[model samples]
Target: MKNKQWMSVLLGLTLGGFNFAAEAQTRPNIIFLMTDDQSIHSMGCYGNGDVQTPNLDRLATDGMIFDRHYATTAICMGSRATVMTGLLEYRSGTNFMHGHMQKSTWQKSYPVLLRQAGYRTAFAGKFGFDIQEVPGTKTLPVPSHDFDVWKGGEGQTSYSTKKNESMKEYADEYPHCTLSYGAFGRDFIKESAQTGQPFCLSISFKAPHLPRNADNRFNKLYKDKIFTKPDNFGRENGLHFAKQSHKTRGYNAFEDRDYDKDYNRVIAQYYRQVYGVDVAVGMIRDALKEAGIDQNTVILYTSDNGYFCGAHGFGLKALPYEEASRVPMIIYDPRHSNSGKGLRSATLTGNVDIAPTLLDLAGCSIPEGLDGRSMLSVYEKPTATIHESLPLINVWGVSASHALTVVTKDHKYINWSYAGENYEVTEELYDLNRDSLELVNMAQHPEAKETLKKMQKLYDGHVAHWGQQAVDYNSYQQFGMLFDRTKTWAEKEPFVVELDRASHQSVK
Candidate 1:
């Protein structure tokens, strides 16, 4: 390298040395890939000694791995909505039972903004939520016409490729949805590269999520493999958890999912399903190289949410615990000097930051009043911080599991306000720095009183924000009082009667 080039590289490595406008004529192509219900523990790059994720590991090596990335909402639909709009769940106003995303919000999403900015955009796999013209009006079809290419499906898209209408063409050759997404990515990359226009391809893979139906091609990969259990992985370790959390189905998932009866078999299959996603990642990376656009293209990879995988005796995501909320995040910008240095950042990031990050990379103006900020600084300098704290919300499923929590780098505070009959209002605190596995609840610890009070203040701020800014529709406004610590259980009782009645019976 020449002296001037070396100096330029050094300057680019500074905290705020972003090259936002150097290439006015050509912006890097962005490929955002997300998986469903994949835990950070499932990846080889995340220090899982038992998994095979060479492609993702290599990507981590070539880029920066964010160790503290969290899904603001640890469920599929809510997390996806947060990622799309750079808003928290109450503001996004879209989830399984809440409702559809408003057309106005969808218009301002990252994809629509990028498309409007004259970039080629494509989408494939499960489009988590649909669009509604207005709050409670008739729903519209998935916004396929907004993108240059559309292979996305609605609802829980099938693992069988042929069953998905848009992906049927690749069914014969790929057969399964995981590999079919890879082929779709390859084709999109090749076709986009030919057009000389910057492209953004977002592929949402349905692997490692439900119905286990992983590709049969890799059946022998982990056959009869006895997986190592996490330290906090059973009913005993979960005894310290709040009584309200125990009332939720997540607490009972250990037995329901047979993790207790068939530990080795269940885990092997879980990792096996993740393995298929790894293979598809390899396929897409190879396509990028073959298309000769790998250098100028940026790749952002993460999961919609992390799975419990028997952690804390829980099964799937939606809890505020680390295992269920913090997912793997990697950003690779080949044009930056920071590429290929095997870097890892512990900066606090959340799902809401994804949109702002992508929009910033495209040199598009970030919308005003976003809950997240651009991570370009964090990307330029790994130690740089983007968020002081982020919320981990769970309003889905049984009312007992519903929580409002806030997490800083070293501490997490969760509040379960569902107190009717047998349940009581509960508060749980964890010292993430000392007990990342959540082996102990520090909420009642005498020495931790000061820290607990501080976290409670932060939690209160989030609850206040929910009251002030949450959308008026979809029953979101009710949560303002329900989650308010100042509000007594008597004040909250009337709002939760129906939910309590329905959930109490459903869980049993």
Candidate 2:
């Protein structure tokens, strides 16, 4: 009887060990999704009230949503570098929005680190850094990227008809699809999940971007809704840096546009592009579930930066305004100890935290080169905030000037340099709580003098850290990118306005 009882106990122990090994073999896969220039307020989850982002909203319902998240920089390359490297734009020195990436400086990006860790990694969609025209470009792969599978780069400004200039050499084996960016993303997710190996896949969406175009289906999604312009629309820039930045972008949200026609179409099209991206997210989530790994994959959805979208009378990105810098950052870790349903955290977060967060979650060593702290501890201890406050800085990308913005929990300060130097000569400051639209400037106000001084110190500290010694806070204004007649648009070749005295002469 004793021998029989011992035999039964040993068999039960053996079965339990087998089950544990199987569970251990199931390492979590990561599906990282990022959109270009999408505003946080544009999504339903973020309370846009109009934009239909059902997929992302669902993800929020299932996982955790981070409010008050920010992008380290408001440009494509800068933002991407921060997220991938877990470093600030200043730390990585890839602050420029579009340019060649120095491989030596940015080799420590998370994807490369994941590759080193034996995770099959793939990256797809708009690779925006190498922005200049290529020479008979057969493919658009960045010369420095270490992504094992790279299928990316929409060649033109328009998202709808982005001509596929070339496929990356590594992506040659995969069947290339030229459908809308959404469809391409959905297909990539479907294929990657079938690999049956633990993998890290990044789906970068390039939509709701300028020359904005959407698939025909989404074009009609919100065609009938009466879209309202931003509440802070047409806010004035009391700061010189902001004013010049506004002038450079031609901040005429409602002026040049024919309200009778273009306004509704633009809004509708923008939402459609957003909806298509949402649909892609849903497809990816569904694919994970269909592959029976939905409960094990860590899904993250966010944007590189926010778009002005008619806010502050501007349409494009690269500004220090909240509308341009605040992006949507959401992380859905299935194995997370935090709330599994509809969890919301207001702890300050940004692209800089992405790499460290993922690395910590993966049980990988966080590299010392990064500037961001892993949120793993934040997730465990919600009481402790990451930073007392964070500073935001925006230098010129194509031009030589500075637009510096400082964001606190309740206040925001901006100093614009039109000459790209001399701060005291020109600047703007606003109390966001009192003036959400920022129509009034409190910089020169006597009562706000102390606040301005403190903000100045913060801005100075960031500038020094970033190696922007040329910024003359006293007189910070200069022409960064000069217009050239050789770069004429095909649509504008017919008209010429030559300056004659104080007037213009029309060239016939």
Candidate 3:
């Protein structure tokens, strides 16, 4: 009887070990693909009749698409920082080109947590954050040691040049920087799969951002395509341009040339660059399948921030407009049985939610004090809502004109503050249900007074919750001068200076 009892115990232990191994094998591998300055309106699946994005369209068809995803800050560095740390710009202190993220904040980043949890991680392409080049400092704040593989760029990498260290290997193999990024991503996936561990690969593409350069092969992709101008293309509402100062307008690419000729050529080139990104997407997908990890991988695609293709007479982002703040978000999780393939979700999501959602999906412990909530519930149920409202910020360095916008499902409220020598502020409201394009501002409309008041309350609640305060131009200018490259090291004695105009260019 004692022998039989011992035999039963050994068999039970064996079964438990087998179950544990199976569970470990089933953990989903994650691949996050991010593009630079890509708007939702520029993609084929998002109703762009002119853009040719077959791979992105296929990814949408195989997964879920979000219609109302927004960036907390409509700029590259701020948005990328939000994605990495799961914290808004105000909380993370990584807003604009002003401050580097704190070391304590980097400890709680998703990649760092995932690496500690035994997942093999790789980061390829642009890690869009501004790091000040101090005279004696040997290192910046970038968390390079958190991943098993790290091939990233400092700022906006060139689209056509091989100057970036990360793209040197693939410079000759691929025609454009976008394709080189994809190739590196493919290699990382194959190498990680060989280790037999669940991997998280992040591919951030530096395409269609600035200089609008594309591979020569794609020059004919949109040659015959003549895009229609946006309804608010030419500043039909005089109040819109009134809010922008001359300096802000110059940074926004608002040329005095005719809209027809400029819009067609620039947008066509942008589309061509996007096409190169699409090709790279196809290559990466093929790599996953070739490595036999396709079924167990969750592929997510989004952009750092949206771009303005001549919307409201502006050609770049850094505005509170929908074209700049809203981005394309898609999640393709093949392991999810109830995902309802090709689902369209209108749940309000933002860049801040990416880190927590990824950590939650990876079965890792999400640290406390994260501003973003897990989006896994919304992915499971398409009708769910994550955030009732999100605050949009565009505090570009120490610039005179900055914007704070509160966006909800059906309305948007913007406050443009010129916090310079002369203080001025402008308010604008839009009822999105009636005016999706935001062509009409109802801030002064008598009938919409109650709606405007409600929006104000919501904005106040967000400001209180996030600890946001009015911009202190004096302090901002004093701190900003420390990192100014043009200034000598000895000039670091605290002094207030104008914002570096060269830093506000559109290339970034």
Candidate 4:
């Protein structure tokens, strides 16, 4: 482990994706594909018995499957910010009701840094958040100018290809936005290949999201098919969860109303949308091969955040639970020696690690003040560990469900500070190794006393770091006081966000 750490640092200083090159390293083309509201359960590689995702499964087989990867901030807007900036949500200062990501932060993002360092960079599909010159100012602009090819849309991009402004060209052919994004990647790869330049392409797919408008081509594909429910599927499994965690749409699955009424049918429709992404994944890989850059191109697939899919009796996401924050992550670097080794890494990783890893593959220096470290070392050796701990945050939505949680490779600790008339300051501890479904809460168990104390110390360290590094503007500075476990509910209640940023909205 010590040797791996030393060598990874050496590679960070010197080599690109190709491992330990004594001379100059060949920079590989990077393609990052991310989906909306995808869970680890959606893929066949993750041991789902019902779903059919051959392309994603093949990518995992061709390279490595990350079993413990997570989105540090488990929401679309917030997680996307963390993925791009290599920073935590508080430091990035980006979310729906949170604030805008500073232009300076966007400048340090992987695409910007890679382009500056002589790599062609392209971005398409849901751009997620707009950039401002500062955190608090209202002057926001789409960062299309930052990338070489910008086919990105703002604000939860439409699933219909014709609806998205930059993607209308493909609507006549693809119709659906999921396949249009794939075509964009194919075109970019073909163009970049002809230029003989290493390129970084990111395609964020708006598939498998809510409101159930999956591609018609894939409609009824999963019809009459009953999906397998996770072990922690019903309300009985969620009784031990904190009461504060169940105040919003996140708890809708337990009510058996609307989308949650028919778990089999609704879950099947979600899988059908994921099936659209699977076909798109196949398209990108086929294009790479046709362009003859397949051997030198690296591909990574993950999600902004995970869907609940009725896990822990929760229908939607944004909770600090396994099915919500623990997303699907796969990295295939064909230029590296470790490629095609059929590896599964249990090392803990997070959304912030994506930028650093991509920059490292491009042979660009990672900027300072980043909370993420490159996961290429873990990619090289499946047993290696890059991140020992990461914070899972949810400061959006109703205040009752907003909480701060910390997770390690083996255990997780969550703190819900919204204590009042109906809720108390709650704590949850789970030995994730033994209870991957989060079916058991060891917070107050007698045998978990020693483990709980160690996790509490880790939790404290995160809170301290949040205090020191959280953005001072846009009400983010208050979460530090709000998340403090030692602070009383009365003392910290005033620190919460003041505005009701769509608290009345049905979905977060």
Ten contiguous residues minimizing lDDT sum, candidate 3: 470-479
In model 4, what lDDT does residue 46 have?
A: 96
User: RMSD of candidate 1 to the true fold?
Assistant: 6.3
**Which parts of model 4 have CA positions greater than 4 angstroms off?**
1-25, 253-260, 497-508
The digit string of per-residue lDDT tens for model 2 on 58-169 reads: 8887777877677868877778767887766555544442233345544677888776665667777766554213311232347335776666653323343334443433
lDDT for 97 (candidate 1): 63
Worst 10 residues of 1 by lDDT: 15-24
Candidate 3 lDDT tens digits, 184-267: 878988887776778889989888787768888787777867787666665553345434433564234756433435777777
Q: Which candidate is the best by lDDT?
A: 1
Q: Count the clashes in each prediction.
A: 0, 27, 0, 0
Q: How much lDDT does each candidate structure score?
A: 0.88, 0.62, 0.75, 0.86
Q: Candidate 2: global Cα-lDDT? A: 0.62
lDDT of 1 at 175: 92
Better of 3 and 4 by TM-score: 4
Q: After superposition, how far is residue 79 of candidate 2 from its true place, in Å?
A: 1.9
Q: What lDDT tens digits, residue by residue, belong to model 4 across residues 1-508?
A: 6998788777656545423232123788899999999989989999997999999999999999999999998889899999999999999988877677888888888888988776778989887887888754665678888888899988888988999999999999999888898888889999888876688899999988876888888876888886667888878888999999888777975565344468877888888899999999999999999999899899999999998887777877888999999999999999878888778999999999999999888878889879999999998788998877999999887787779999999999999988866888899999998988888899999999998999989989999999999987766778888888888888866544353443333123
Ranking by TM-score: 1, 4, 3, 2
Candidate 2 Cα misplacement greater than 4 A, ranges: 1-27, 95-99, 131-145, 154-162, 165-196, 235-242, 250-261, 381-383, 397-401, 419-424, 432-440, 468-508
Clashes of 3: 0
